[model samples]
Target: MTTVFRKALGALPRLGVQVLDLGPGAAVVSRRGGYTATKMSGDSWMVGGKRPRTRTTADGWGLHKAAAGDLCARHVADLLANYEVNCVFDVGANKGQYGRQLRELGYRGRIVSFEPVPDALARLRKSAERDPEWRVYPFALGRSESFEDMHLGWKTMNSLLQPSAYGQRRYKRFTDTRKEQVRIRRLDEVMDEALEGIAEPRPYLKMDTQGFDMEVFAGAGRRTADFVGMQSEVAVLQLYEGSPRMNEAIAAYEDAGFAITGMYPVTREKTTGRVVEFDCVMARAAAAPSRQG
Candidate 1:
């Protein structure tokens, strides 16, 4: 149903129709050819043409290209609100872009960002200096505590893992142009220390650590239960050496009591229309009922 609606909505602009929002879940569509479509209800529409006696439900009519981003942003904002998330762990935060986006989307909660790269950390600190609620850390999270060589890419594509040959071939920008030694620590070991003294810490975790998401999750260990929701970047293709594939990432989250709620494509190959990576939003899975005595 969503696919059908998306296809129909995608064809609207080409047909000279402009979609105008009337209110929540309703819209007024005007065509350049002097026709107007006013949504009366989810299941009813009024056409400006000859008063046709038949009326049909306009269920999925208002979705448009320009509104997709807004829809996603609102969806995430609602999730944060629903869970009453007080703190967001912005893992693999490079230049605090994810944190900034969350703030732009109206999330007023506290944000703790972790970035290990020297230059990137500097920029992240600068960007977050004005926001007292947004804190920046100078370390990376992984399966264990140690120092590791980070592969630096053209811009924000740096990762602890080496890029696969296919990754370099598909996107030259992901090529490991240089290396930086960064401090890495296990999230479980430092979770309490990092989030110390929070009165009500309902943490929402968001990770964009290139292809090292699974390791981060593993490092979270029992601390995963403390989070109400999490979002991580998962690969559809093998972009980095030893990176978990989409299914593997999903299974890991499931094992940690999380259920996949949403997925948004982050990168795609233009030629093949294949998704390279996507961000998966997960929430704590509901527990099954106990057996009757």
Candidate 2:
């Protein structure tokens, strides 16, 4: 990328243009107006435009969502309102970032966060001290109850599965191999306890367990339908051993009767400029209220 081109790209975000992909001689950009601009090569740009519509907002949530240019947040806000999400079960709630983001989006519902790592749990607890609606749990949710070793990577990259060679090579932080034996519990087993004090719980489940999302879903078992909506980190490229690919994860959600609402790229491979993983949001199709004539 040339300096002039880089500078221009930097300024595009202010205009609501998000650079989704950039390669050796090509680029893919999208806008809130539902248009995609792709550069084939040598200044040949193909523009795919949708019917323009005004984006008007009166609330703090809409303002934050529009200003941040986060499609995931906007989608989550939509689902919460549509599905009447009164409680959120934040699986893999590392250091309460997701919870904090929820509050920023003006969500005032109950937030129950689960984190197994001692260091992360400590920080997550401290951050929720001022918020009475936010609660924390100190165990990981998985397919079954057992003491399993968790790969403790740098910051929020912790995982239950071992990191692959490609993962370590592509992301240097994954090279860390510190292991901690953490308690793994099934969400179904503790679902009642988690919802004990909450009244009329309409839940949304969000999982970011570093490739362990499938296991967490499995742990939820038959109670998965209790959640009106869910969000998971689906991987296009396998980063951890035994982690299901994007297709498999999406299939699981679909089989469970959820319809995909949105997918926003979370990370990209630097060399290939391909999406490594994305936040996939899905809602139970049957949960939507029928429209009256």
Candidate 3:
């Protein structure tokens, strides 16, 4: 039924709802008003009546172009299947869109969502209101419980754990409207409780914690072994400053006994050049007994 639903959704007529500028970032629009879509446009277009810029869409969803950094809608579904995901850690969840995308992809397993922005968190909670398994965590994910200065942008751009926030600090200048001391928690801090709280025997992690991908795993510690795979939104450019942050992530997984199997470019190829951004890192868990052996 879900497959049929997805197909039906896929079969519906699509539009060239390209992603437009949210001033500093991108957003998706339905040229047909948030319904089904077909061939997306190759050029940049505006949404919410804003000016257009370079944009792209996911492979399947045809629902206009979206600027979700490296993590696109197609990647969202791909991660759901690729990881054989049971439980997901939707870190840096903005308005529960990541979780919604996964659910829309027929991911029926548990979803543990976390978001930091108070307003965004509220919307995230409201989005998850009907679902029981989709647990929306309201807090900032980071290296620790320290007061990490997070820049909250509008829409999906609201992130302290993403490259955009870091970029907002580095490249762009903005005056922060609301700043609060959010409780920054590590993954390891809530693993036992979180895992016990969900349905899966062992859950996979889908981390899009802004640019703080590495530190979340670091916080995961030894319990990181419990995950089957990971799809993280890594900040390869800003955080690593042009070095391979993906390789660094692989090393972290290796240290934790996981292997980096596949990588997905987070950009929509239909747009433009090598200036592509984002990668969904898929790491498979090492055999437990063999690791001990």
Candidate 4:
């Protein structure tokens, strides 16, 4: 019945519906109008018609509640504030979602967003047009400059790495990849220009390039020190083939002189109830202390 319902939803155009599993005996249907209905263990449905109101933090991941926006956005904002971040490089900015969230969270820094997906980049540019502080770039960031085929996943889950078998089995959308050739540039080559005109440029790097975050990080080279803080979406379970696991990614960041400020679960697997990914925020160890200290 679930499979049939999902197929029916897919058949409909512009339905804007997504079915997400929240562990055993729990499922959530999210609709276009910001409505959500959750199926509980005993076949009871908990429905909310309006958009979800999210606070900064909860006891855990808040899985029982309606899908909250990025659980770590506020944390990122806080880190930005703490480090006096004056500019931000929003790598993999999909339609300016993260930039908007940062603004709502009271961050007034300059946002330089990079996106390679044509459709998404168009929307991202439009979103940033009214806000002079927000800038949009039209190429993907990677370890080197070149063109690569990006596999588009569900929503903004597109990546250079192929989705793994586990990802396809857990999320049906992984099977529907539409590849697009995109230009990739190294951050080291563009960093100075991106930061141009920003006074006392204390930068923050926010990356959500699905599984290619490390590559983006590598692109920064020794200039990683230029950032006061950074955020990366690391996989707890390898969703994309060749993507680094959580531990490896964390270690890499630590080795690069960044220390974890906070770690927030992004999503969990249905069957095993394991965290699938995390929005891990880190800051340069030498600069992580709070102003109040």
Candidate 5:
């Protein structure tokens, strides 16, 4: 491999783009090659870099490899051909960075957000206060439709519904917590009440509630729209020992008609032995066999 090829891998790691394979095809799942990624199968993909000879532009400017396009789709054809997504239902929307990014990119549609931690809720609310299109939900969305006393993980910014599952995580970053009761909602129910009146269409959904994506999906019930696209900040199997089951998650999403098309990292290990991690699964609703034609 050339120095540029090596640099592409090393450079994008900083921005959290870890899902790249350098040949032999289908074996990318086991292509750890020292990096961390969710093992995948089936045809739910929009990009490929399996050929060892195709490693040069793995992080180039077009798709089909690893270059950074407008939204990081590894394949140019997918980026340019896929249906355009406008509305966003952002579950577990921490500081509203996702929302901000959408706005920065000139996304002109509704952004319904959900967050559990009070600190994050406040910050997210303030960050989006000026945007009329942003509707922030100061609560967590799960299978339950009631309030619960969720333990604010030590890193309040990285809080989760099940605290003990995190064992003990202590980051030196500035994080604080105030444990008061927080509301939980079944996403479908909340949408029925809060957004039912809107004459416009439904929105695309993004979930990053720790390992709580499946729970949120269940609460969504049959409320899923046909044209909806979904993105999630999913947890990789290797991180957080004893974390939620990955197969169950993939199956749950598949059941909901979402095909996992792409995965991107968002955090890199600052040290040698720690490891780089995080995958945001980009998915789209798949039609039934009968509807595909």
Candidate 6:
């Protein structure tokens, strides 16, 4: 590849363009909008029109980063498309970030988001109001139906489990700032009710409940078989009290008949480069005995 072509390929993610290799010495660039840029030999490029404005939100940046690096969103898109997923259970959906990213990535499935934090839920509701297929629920999913004290942090760090001492020291922004009493329900109890009568619902569950992913899974019960894939935030360090470590989290999911497919780093300790937490994607293992007859 020429230096210019290499640079363009390297910058495509930040530029929000998808490259299609035509052959040696030529490629096509597809952008978010309907415009296309063609790269020819010797630093030569051709564009049909002016470039569209790029997205600047954190979710947009993450999606583009994944697109650039061939990471999380790419795997997610593949799972959704391959499984023909019709429903998405977005657990711990803060401000509908995951749902929004899904739509941007071409997922047209029905989305049911559960968020218990008052402020976050409000924003989530507004974000999904215009989308008829996207529904927002104002409750958390746990091991059972009950009320719990949720520790609220600077932003998305809120969780049912208390922040760990390591978390507080390593990341000051994750310090528990306040507590809120929130209603919690089990996925087994709410899944059918929330997605009643959806035609052939192949659900993809995505959880970002901070340290409470296992509790959420415990509540899923036999309903786990109904899901085609699941994505959860797995902690490397003990970010929250009672939260499972990376190995433990993987083991729990594996025991549930899912196999690890992808791991996307979410945060890292700035100095030591130790992973803080990452998103783990799992699909039902093919070798596992079929739940259906």
What is the lDDT of every predicted structure here?
Answer: 0.77, 0.82, 0.60, 0.81, 0.58, 0.80
The TM-score leader among the candidates is 4
Over 187-219, each residue of candidate 5 has an lDDT whose tens digit, in order, gives 877775555445755456777776677778778
RMSD of each: 9.9, 12.2, 10.0, 12.2, 11.9, 9.0
Question: Which segments of model 2 are wrong by more than 4 Å?
Answer: 1-69, 291-293
Off by over 4 Å in 4: 1-71, 288-291
**Whole-model lDDT for model 1 versus the true structure?**
0.77
What is candidate 3's local distance difference test score?
0.60
TM-score of each: 0.74, 0.75, 0.64, 0.77, 0.61, 0.75
Highest lDDT: give the candidate number. 2
User: Please, what are the lDDT tens digits per residue for candidate 3 over residues 1-293?
Assistant: 44554444454445444332232233343454532222223333323333235433333222222444323555545555655566888877878887887777578887888887788889999989999888887786656767666655545554453344435454343334344566788888887766674455657777766456777777777777778767776444553232236556667667776665555555433423332345555555443224333
What ranges in model 1 sit over 4 Å off? 1-71, 286-293
List, residue by residue over 1-293, the lDDT tens digit for candidate 1. 45655566667878879765344455556674344555433344445543335643221222221133344455667788777778899998999877888898679888989999988999999989999788888999988898999888658888898888888898778743788788998888877766777887888888889888888888888899898889888899988889989998998888888888787666666556576777788877442112311
Question: How many steric overlaps are in each model, in order?
Answer: 1, 0, 10, 0, 8, 0
lDDT of 2 by residue, 18-101 (tens): 774444544566675455554433433445555236633322233333323365776697789878788999999999988998
Task: Please estimate how well model 2 matches the true structure, expressed as its whole-model Cα lDDT.
Answer: 0.82
Sorted by lDDT (best first), the order is 2, 4, 6, 1, 3, 5
Q: Which stretches of candidate 6 lie over 4 Å from their true place?
A: 1-70, 174-176, 287-293
Candidate number with the higher lDDT (2 or 3): 2
Residues 117-194, candidate 6, lDDT per residue (tens digit)? 989989999999999999888999999889989888668878788778997887687744788899999999988877
Query: What is the lDDT, from 0 to 100, of the residue 230 in candidate 5?
Result: 69
